[model samples]
Target: MIENVPEKAPEPITGPSVVVLDKQVPTVSDVQQEEARRQTKMDAAVAFAREKSDRVRKLAASQQSPFQGNSTGKVIIPNTKVGQGYDLFAPVDKKKMKVLFDWLKLDPDAFINILRLQYHKNPHHFRSGRIYFLDHVFSRIWRDKYPEFKSSEPDHNGCKKKAPWRGVDDIYAPVNFKNTHWIAIWILIPKKHIVIWDSIAKHISDEELAEVMEPDQWIIPYLLVECAGSGELCVQYTLKPFTYMRVTAGVSQCRAGDCGVFTLMYIECHALGMSFSPAFSSRNVKAIREKMAVDIFQEAPESHDKENNDNDENVTTYEQ
Candidate 1:
């Protein structure tokens, strides 16, 4: 109060103040806001990826086969879920069906498994991969008129069918291929004819197909012919000269895995007594997948059938 002091000078600024982060950094609400932002970005990315994937798949499918689309020229995606049906489509189930598709390399046990399932699923169903089993000239005689020739699982394990050729009229053989291929030998019992209907005419030889499916057997004295020191004639078994005709038209599988779809459709058409047409090759693999899933869901036993929904997580891996 007596004397005025010099005004205090302001302290000179140095640098920016350092912020210390403690355990209490970022409050709960702040973290939640950041997470929400991240989730929004993730959702956008997922949508973009899904769109691109769908487009590519569509293009690939289009090139493989022709399919009927909506009026806007959009391929109609079938309704997977019906009253009760469908799980994984065909392409997704490829691994499960790989062995079945590869008739040439399928092991005995694997082949029997399919037969067992087919046997149980629908006894009268005309459609099955088993029909191709008859490609062999000598298959231990599924139901040979004589019990001596009749064959069964080792030690006679499986049940006998009503007839040797139960639930089959055509042999649908889908060949693993560079592009695609399906060949069938239509067995007309009444006509006593075995006609090869290959999309790629003569692409597969009769002997080769027959050899691939024939049951394994030790060389028996009876089968061995005494021909110039001995051997069976004409493919190990004496086959009656059945009329052989090759169907070389309209039936074609143009891409990988197309054999499965085309063959399945062929069987369906044959079951319904429809003439073979170009539509089969045109029914793209995607639709085949959807249709197959639906068929499996509807036809498979309830115990085997998971919920008829498109939950990829619930896919049932077929045992090898």
Candidate 2:
């Protein structure tokens, strides 16, 4: 075997052996294209579902609705029931009244005027006259109300500066004689603005009014007087720490007139920290209140007729 054995045949390479070492790398572009396709399919499904839902909702609303296309051309009016018997002057207890007076820091005359306005048989008669008197009263009360907060004090540099704790001085009263259903009063404070709403012929409690103010903070005393037959009155302070101010009644029905007194008051308070001066004179305020009242009462019949016609149109359109 050693002498003449044939050379062993080289074993042939068998089965699957690792010959070329090609790295099994995944292409990023291919993965991204696949993902993009999946996302596109998902988006299409979502859009289709949304369209189907909207169509179903529209169909359901069409079958059951009464005023589908009448919103643009009609003045809708709410029906008032005869003799629903709402009390215009709801009596307040002495304790509640006292709390209100303390909260507002009102003087005796101002307090009396508030009471008189609340109890008056005809609020419009006192609208102009009382507002002037109240303006003077408010000026005096505001001077006395914020003595500590308004006073200058020595700061870290030994120079006098206005105290950091300040209260809002702007007050707004929006009386709508034309719309005697409700009255709104606005008070702008350094920290926030408050709105008080009272039913024209109803009484609102002090507790309810307090709810309109920010909680857990010192609130500057303010008063809201609502004469259902006249207008709403608010006594507030100005940016000048101790200055008293007032805003007259505003009518919301007119597009130009609906400046959203409440919204403006809030914005001003938020931006400037609750201090503002009166923008209108007392006489102007009174005049506006009187004019609005006359307009409201005189327009009642026409308003009712317009409402009826609008309703008829709406019903007809919906039926069609």
Candidate 3:
């Protein structure tokens, strides 16, 4: 997610005789061109990742076996979408599905870039390693995906010797549930808050949101505690320490299929510190889908990703 980086200052012209020069200025068209280049590069990366994703899908579809969970082990959610919640995801929208699918297809770097783009815009505001990597976040490993070779893990297994959440700032999680719907979770460290946003409100209950996490792992408290070790073992240090919080922003998805888009918009708008309303969530979803279709996909650790996403924007933790 490295876009719009701060450019270096121009060096002074060195000579025996000094020449007075007027202050330089960039034109509006120049600024527009630069922005276009940045966006075009992003869109190109997104498009390329989509192609790779399509190929893998076609190959998988051609074969008899189920998808191998890509490289992140996201294979399938073990029939979470089939039970009573089936009706919630019913009356599916084809266009919305395509948008979600396109988003899932992004390669890891492309995905990270989307997150990086926000950080790049406001570096001073966000902690450097604050994002919490989740299973549903679309990503492709940089070492394999990028040609120049940027390695994320030390050993071949993509495992770092230590965990990356020692002093985290903010967190971003994109989640898929029961293989049906998508949701998002964001921890606002500056505000001392955790926000859970779900597109399908009626389908997901308040009680359900309260427990939307692994049996023994709770990420909200982890951010507050000191992680003793690194990588997968880090969770042992802070396993489900009691936590309590509430949803800062709770709203329903206006349309059936736009839940995913709303989840993403929540992230984008929140990252920008902008207020989001029902109108933003309901309309212009296709635009959001198209943008996501173009950027995707990061790598840190599998444990960091095993966490699920929920709504409420508040943790509302309890002692166990």
Candidate 4:
């Protein structure tokens, strides 16, 4: 007699089932992938910004000096190996070059005058800035000799050469005389010096001619005067001429050992006789009056005025 008894219901699982954790847990690959994507975006942005900055810098440089381009054509400075026949040397240092450029920037008129004086003193040695210097000297000489003669020609030879005065007609004519503004002087320096066929009629003062023969204290003194009147003159201890060997050594040797000989290319353009308006003069007068009032109220008025005037002159001269 078997009584039908329901098998006791399987005991309900008491609590949560035991979870088996894998030793090698799944990595957060999706999160990592998202982070990588973000990092890539950041890098791209940085690269784009850098590229934009470079472009802006280049554009600014171009705008500042429009005439500065390789379009004027190329002038090569040939390489001279160690065993070259002549001993090559550099005539100027980097600092000196800066000084020279600075002098050129301020009072270009003074630079022109100095160059003319130098050419008159010594025409044979062939100075570095020969052609341009000659041009300035010729213009001045022509003006002095023929005050009434108003032709487009610039002749220092005193009407000797058959070459008619092709003044404004010449491509390299002075800026203000014509409505033209662009002016450039190109020089081709080969391995050896090129002989200028045109005879430079010797027109120099007795003192200058004597100094040329004797390049000692006398000549240097005259040069110093010219330099002083022009602007602040800074001369480096070392005076090196631009040369091929120097350029080669600069490229090949240790940077410190590299020579600082720059193959110079220069262009100067003037905005057609742009003069300051009377408004500027009024503004200057107002400034002067204000300054005077302040000085008059000072304890040592006379001393203050003197010092202020000196300072003002210095500032004005520098601005010019």
Candidate 5:
């Protein structure tokens, strides 16, 4: 105790010592956190790709025809053989078939003609009545050249073939407006009313109606007078006035440039005597178009007889 030993050197004043290892090892929690972070990144990436794909699809859908690589693109129905005595309506050739392909507006020759043939062939499906089918051009031709053909004699204008509507209950015509819109006109002969199914408008102005509906109102009665030949049919239509009407079935086009398809469908439904249902809309219109094309092809006389040879020049493959 008397010996003054130097105060033991204070222990080295160092902070808590750090351990050194040959290789640092991660804890279980550290591994779990890293895996969760990786999974989050992958999910985010997948979501981003899905959004971009959806955007591209929507844009393509807006610009192109919905029926691009459908079943309709498989093969082309051959042209009717010459001198076959095949009285086919709306025979599909290379040109006419193209209407159903390539985002083109439905041409009158291909679409309405084939439909008329279908109506005639399957009478069971159609309403039992004397329904007269007029081509798409019939109304517009009369509209543009009304008085010019008023006195031209129905025979001269080939009205003889479409004549003798002794007991015609209805007349259906597909009409085009401004060469860009399609609508259906149903002349209810007994009702003396023209019901128009316009996919574009629910109701048009009276003035517009008067102007647009003039051809039908005037020419139909006149044709009746000429073709009916002073019979009861002629007298009835001549005496009474035809009124204009717009269908109130809540049927309107939900997509653009689909007016033609809507017009054709309206005529078909009325022809079948079926009520317009919500099932028919722009949603499944592309599928409808594909079916229509196939139907037209099968209706061709050559379709059943001919073999589809790839080497044959007449047999062209369908192009999108």
Candidate 6:
């Protein structure tokens, strides 16, 4: 019945076959699906970080405020009126406090003055006036010389103006470089070092930062000399060379908008002579922001109380 070939295997029945290749090429759909998965993972990670940050903020906000008295939570600084420029004693309304809420950017009034108040509160912890947080406008004055401080004048007029830098060991000045980023310029007068604290230092070149500070190196020393000569800038002025360096170590922010907060923290840590606490990272920044707002809002009256606490060794008046 069967030939030598046997009954031909019923002609091999096959539909459109998947020709298996050693390596299959990915289709556009495959690529798209893979990309979508990657994106979803990233979104999930970001959401988790944000959730953790929010929890920390809420917990800290619920704790008892260190400040005494029923917190009005109204005026940040009483008596002094707002819109009088960036005065250290200027009044800040609730709206300014709102900026410290929800990761909002801090204006000079909100941060610098709050810091001044905090430092002013615990004077025994820090040497009064030894650490000066200059107004953000200090940079502007440095760039566009004030008429009173014009180079042509050669002197601040023998009238003996107040030199805030008098007896200051560290000057934490916020420099808004190019109107884009906020950075801290820490001038250690004794160390003769101009240390830069920037959240995005890695993204910038040492050369660029040095260039931006070149003018300051000369102007600052000159100003110090001028003040020491005229006003109460009592630090030992050696006129020696000052070294400029950018801080590349420590916790840095993962986002761009956090530079303002980071700058404030840098000043705080350095002023306290403490290394950046683990609590000062990007995850805790929201908490830091909330605490700052609370400290500012509640401590509005602390300035007056501080002035009255002259006999209390734990507190001392910040004399300019």
Clashes of each: 2, 10, 32, 10, 0, 0
Per-residue error (Å), model 6, residue 124: 1.7
lDDT of each: 0.42, 0.35, 0.50, 0.30, 0.64, 0.64
What lDDT score goes with residue 236 in model 4?
19
Question: Model 2, range 80-156, lDDT digits (tens) per residue?
Answer: 33585977796857796545433222212332233233325453543222222112223233333434433545344
Better by TM-score, candidate 5 or 4? 5
Error (Å) of candidate 6 at residue 108 is 3.8
Which of the numbered candidates is closest to the native, going by highest TM-score? 5
Error of 4 at 266 (Å): 21
> lDDT value for candidate 1?
0.42
Go through the candidates in order and give the C-alpha RMSD of each one to the true structure. 23.6, 26.5, 33.4, 27.4, 18.2, 22.3
Candidate 5 residue-wise lDDT, 128-209, digit = tens: 6478676654465567776554445545433422323346778888887776677788998778789989877743555776
Candidate 6: list runs displaced more than 4 Å. 1-104, 127-129, 146-165, 230-241, 301-320
Per-residue lDDT, model 2, residue 250, is 38
- The segments of candidate 3 whose C-alpha lies over 4 angstroms from its true place after superposition are 1-112, 121-164, 188-193, 214-252, 294-320
Q: Mind giving the per-residue lDDT tens digits that candidate 1 earns over 1-320?
A: 59978999999889899877897678999999999999999999999997765663333344344454342323443323246455454355666655433532221222223333564666566454434332111232321322433342322212221222223334433333223344444554334455555544455576765542232112111122211122433233222334556666556644543444555455455644467766556445565555555444455423122242322322331110
Q: Could you tell me every candidate's TM-score relative to the true structure? A: 0.35, 0.18, 0.42, 0.16, 0.56, 0.54
lDDT of 6 by residue, 240-283 (tens): 45788887777565478778888888887777777887777889
- Arrange candidates, best lDDT first: 5, 6, 3, 1, 2, 4
